[model samples]
Target: MDIVLAPLATDITCAPSTAVGQGGALIEARSDREAITRWLIEYRHSPATFRHYRKEAERFVLWLEFRGLSLDALRRHHLDEFEQFLTNPLPSSHWTGPTRPRHHPRWRPFRSGLAPASRRQSLVILQGLCGWLKEAGWVTHNPFALMRDRRRRLDNAAPPVIERYFEREWWCAMWKLLDPPVEDAPQRSRFLIARRRFLFGFAYLMAPRIAEISRARMNDFRLEEGQWWWHVVGKGNKVARLPVPDDMMTLLREWRAELGLSDMPPPHDDSPVLRALDRRRGVTDNQLYRVFKDGFSMLSDALIARNWSQDHPLIEQLRRATPHWLRHTSLTHQAQSGIELRYLAMNARHARLETTARYLHAENDEWQRQQARHRLSRIE
Candidate 1:
């Protein structure tokens, strides 16, 4: 059987079949693909969550098609095999390709093999899908429930240390590159320089996720009781009003002025904070991601031009840095500056102190110093 690999959960509004599955199903979805589409609709309000769940579900469905099986036909042993497959998807030609539009003929299910964390996340999502399907009577039982070590395999209780952030020295260097003197900056590129300055300044100070930055509007920044605050709709559709510091407000003012807006945007102004080259329309999340990616690449080139080794820690970090690193850098720097854990959690919008605590590296610094005491004495 030659299975042509293609995306499966692309259409959220895909009509469920009138026919029902075995075991008195509640949902009208007869096929695995339709059932997965129904499940994906549950996350429609959360775009990020919808995209994530769809990717995992689509991959699983493609894998099932390759195995000549259906979702309800999944077994514990099959899941174990799928888990292994995620690490090294076989016949890479069919399973992997560079990112492309879903409708593109060359589009594949994966960019490459999943790492351990990514594999765990994929399994967790599929586990939830099976649980939901069981409740909807699409399946007789959740195959995930059959696994003896399900909890141990899926739980991510131990928080990994946050390492993907710019250290102080590197951050300072980046700022210098981002904010060259007005005289030195070319007139044609002033708008771009100002935008980059404000963009990264906003990221470091507010620690907003890329989507938040993309969706931000001028009126999101407002004055209240002699202070400015940025109103945002963040992860899980939660609304938050974060303080706008003096530095960030200055950057906002500069960016707004460059766009020919008032120093402080009026309450009724819903213009996008991050504008396109036209200075009118908003940029998408992918565009925002590219801005950071290209900025880091440019910074890496600048460092190399300055005779910095490619292997230098800062250059290497820049090579791997993504937009999310700004958020990590913001929170980690705040933790290092002795901000109370409670306040740090509030700033990060994290529900648990344990999650925020991962940013704390003071103990690590002290431990390193303590270990230094055990070094062998110098020869006379």
Candidate 2:
């Protein structure tokens, strides 16, 4: 099947007699592709949702094109086929990507395959898209509403929420390597690595999402009610006043000094909290991800060199680490350290206490040891 590239934004908005797809296939002007583009654009107000929903919608659209159908013509059976495709996308499907850009040969939507949780997420996004399109009179019906697969169901049978985070030992090891002696390397190269460490350190201490960190401005740091706090714009555009630890403030000051800035971040300063290496603008989410990823790789290699087996849980976990895992690590460590749930919830910026309680489920060695007191008696 020929791959379908999305119409450029201007192509959809401009008055055009015809549109083109890959291989010069003629698509009817103002078709389902345009409708899908409009739907995805409406979500641009929320960055996270825009990225996620656009992905699911794009994959679905590509599949529809492969079948030579339009979005309005999709039915329940088509969605079932889509689900199957998501589970194991055909190698030739060209719906995959390391980065979701078109024209990349490695672009399959799924790297390995979607887990049950990921499949549910994809279905939910499409369901919402279809619902919106139906309301707008673009589609005749919502096929997702009639999808009956067990994987698409939202009920008690759903898979457990597994929180991935670093333990205390792992955190310490990362920190040790993240910030080495200033003189250990050339001053120029050392400063660059130090900047990255501060970014990861901010995430660890504040537990902010990568997006929040990316958009974090110096003005967001302020002294409120006699305590230093970061006024972060988190998911859902909700503003959270997270308490900044004293040590973090010290590091901030030190890093700024290294940058030749003022001893403290001025209340009126509008610069990013995490500036790019160029020192002119804030780092993007992708740049921040690469920094943490590089750190994870370095730490994993260090451990392996120290004779830690590749099969060791900590080593293996590091190998699979993503930037968000650091947020989980921070919150989980705080819960383990006996921080009160109510306070931890506020610190974590979790809208619900139950969400924060997920960290309490992190395997507690002491709790497990105490529970081990009860054992079944063996028959002689």
Candidate whose TM-score is highest:
1
- Candidate 1 stretches with Cα past 4 Å from truth are 1-3, 9-23, 146-149, 180-188, 369-380
lDDT of 1 by residue, 234-312 (tens): 8878888888889988888788878888899999999899988888999998788888988899889998999999999
On lDDT, the candidate that comes out on top is: 1
Q: Which pairs clash (backbone N, Cα, C closer than 3 Å) in model 1? A: none
Kindly report the root-mean-square deviation of model 2 from the true structure over all alpha carbons.
5.3
lDDT of 2 by residue, 135-244 (tens): 76666678777756535363323334445788788789778877633766877687777787787788888888999988988878898778888888878788888788
Worst 10 residues of 2 by lDDT: 19-28
Model 1, global lDDT: 0.85
Q: TM-score of predicted model 1?
A: 0.89
Superposition error at 109 for model 1 (Å): 3.4
